[model samples]
Target: MLTALNNPRPAMLAVFMLLGGSVAAAASPTITVSWRDKPPYHYLDNGVPKGFLLERTQAIFAAAGIATRLAPEPQKRIWANFSHGATNYCSFSWYRLPEREAVGQYTLPISIDPPHSVLVSGAALARVKTHATLAALLADQELTLGVVDGVSYGPELDAMIAHSANQMMRRTVDTTSMMRMLSVGRASIMLVDREDWEYVHRHEPILQSTTRLDFPDMPPGLKRYIVCSRDISPLVMDKINQAITATGGAVRSSHGTEEERKAHQRP
Candidate 1:
């Protein structure tokens, strides 16, 4: 009788251990992500978050068995929160820089290339016959350039822009307002991502009259990434990268249609 009772106790103990292990494995961590209003890439549609990067990130996290909740906030505030480590938030389609690298860690390449071009009004395009580079475009003494505030143009190019001493304007507001300013002749040229310009043109007909200035080459060393706080576990970064690799290196755009790509490339 004593032997039989001891045998049952051991079996019961093993069952309890197995159940505890299952519970521990099932407790997947949930993380909060921050995003700004960048259309076709990240934005809110009808009060629900939607965009290519947002969707892809969600899919990757889900596949990795990591649950996530997205919180849409202003660009500046989101970065601030992430920087202070007050929030466990990640930002997508971010460019990697040394200064930023110090405070943040990035996943493997999310987008291999970033579309870059000089956007100008139709009237301005007619006046300016040619520009092969951003420097060449800035050579025009009378030309006023607009850039998004808080955006870094990489180290070398950023230094050039800062030293140029040219008449440059910046806005902390949305891209739509920048387009409006250009259309109204408030600025001669606006430096922007080609994808962003196309996104606005397709969705907002108000920018239909704008033209893309042909440059010899795109601004160099531009790539997008999934940025996370430096404090995040290295294991988490590895998991995210694994998920991204499994889905292919590039995140498919929600608005990346064959027709759109072809149309944007047209002369």
Candidate 2:
């Protein structure tokens, strides 16, 4: 029961309502940016939205003369926001998906994350240290992974999980739960961004146990795109990309490496 309070995921529609007025009313052509409560990435600060991407990009968008508002939503609602009849809605950041691309538009990356790492209990790290790729890691039937429901772990990891035996243990909880599960040795694995790893360590020191294994088959980092509803024009995405680039963000190029391996891409 205590875990419920610590890891609450209130309904997305209810959360968006707490923003005082229609997100559309905040700014003309308001880019209603939706985000999950993933700390170090996106989370609420005193009922106002603030986190790495929201705090960093919102100000930049404002400086670029683009109006913005924040909405906290569950992953499903965030996807729905891009479906038909949606307004100028957009996600704060995401690894673009084919389904999302089919329904809306993706801008050049607005944030960058080091290649996702396999977080684990200390004992689990020793077991997986020699494992280079996700496929190799999952070969051990004794191991299981914790996943955030609906989250994309880039193309390579996602594909690997899909094809692997049913070894994944998914939860609707946020990043905190991923860490909590690792601490208690829930499943021995949690895939997360390095930034996410650092963020959890900073705030949950008393509960933190940071042990990570890299997936050498994947790209060196994840590129975050702002997926906008169909109502947003390419010109708007171009302007958004311009603002993003000014803040050290850019689209990922071909993955360069000195080693030969299966290619797990970002798009």
Candidate 3:
């Protein structure tokens, strides 16, 4: 049974009616949640939507007595759709930014943990350590860093990357592909969330031999949240936040190690 954020059945409608007077009372309000392929966060496996963040979102909405459809959309299209009010949707595990807030609302802090280190093959790890500051990191013309295309890492980082004339070479469509590229020496380093990296490392053979270069003292990780369109009612946002809070603030991994947890907890 695939979960959808659009198709509401009669039984679901009946349940909503029974719970009428709540914010979910609006005629089968189906929120088209935006999703992208970020493993251990949001991804499809054997045709089933399975990920920590996606499952947590579903659980949160269910707890709030809200029936929503979880539809997967491309990152850019999802933002565009929500911005135009063409859909009442939200995305799981998104970094909150001022530009995004102008067009959408956010659930309470999902993960305050900073992003983990960029996992690179052993050969590439040797090169990244040579660069100290971000400027030095960017100045290395020989290096090819990989970042997910639509991810935001706050304003300062965004500005820095935006101003960099040769930043395009550092971008990739998804993390898994980026990791593969790193393994094959197609790219030097792949930037990814620490928890996510471990998840992949445990499950994917290609990543098992890779080396993780943690910027423990540097700004690498991003605090993430669930975000919905600004057009969504304040009542809806409140319900979502209530559900998130009730669920203990964020998603708990079913398969994370103590080290990964500690790394995520690091400022």
Considering every candidate listed, which one attains the maximal TM-score? 1
Per-residue CA lDDT of model 3 for 1-267, tens digit only, reads 344445658668878777775543666477777688778778899988988778877888887767788777778887787678765777877777876888888889776544446566667666777755456665677777666677775665666567643334455366777777777777666556666677778888977667775554446456678888777788878988898888888543443566755653323
In model 3, how large is the Cα lDDT of residue 79? 78
Q: In model 1, which regions exceed 4 Å deviation?
A: 1-22, 251-267
How many times do residue backbones clash in model 1?
0
Between the candidate structures 1 and 3, which one is better when assessed by TM-score? 1
Question: Could you say which candidate leads in lDDT?
Answer: 1
Query: In angstroms, what RMSD does candidate 1 have relative to the true structure?
Result: 5.2
> RMSD, each candidate, Å?
5.2, 15.3, 8.9
Please provide TM-scores, in order, for all candidate models, with all chains considered together.
0.82, 0.75, 0.77
Q: Clashes per prediction?
A: 0, 0, 8
lDDT of each: 0.72, 0.70, 0.69
lDDT of 1 by residue, 113-190 (tens): 444667787768765556556676677777777777887766666776676544788888787788878877878887
As for candidate 3, its clashing pairs are 4-69, 4-70, 5-69, 5-70, 6-69, 114-221, 115-221, 115-222
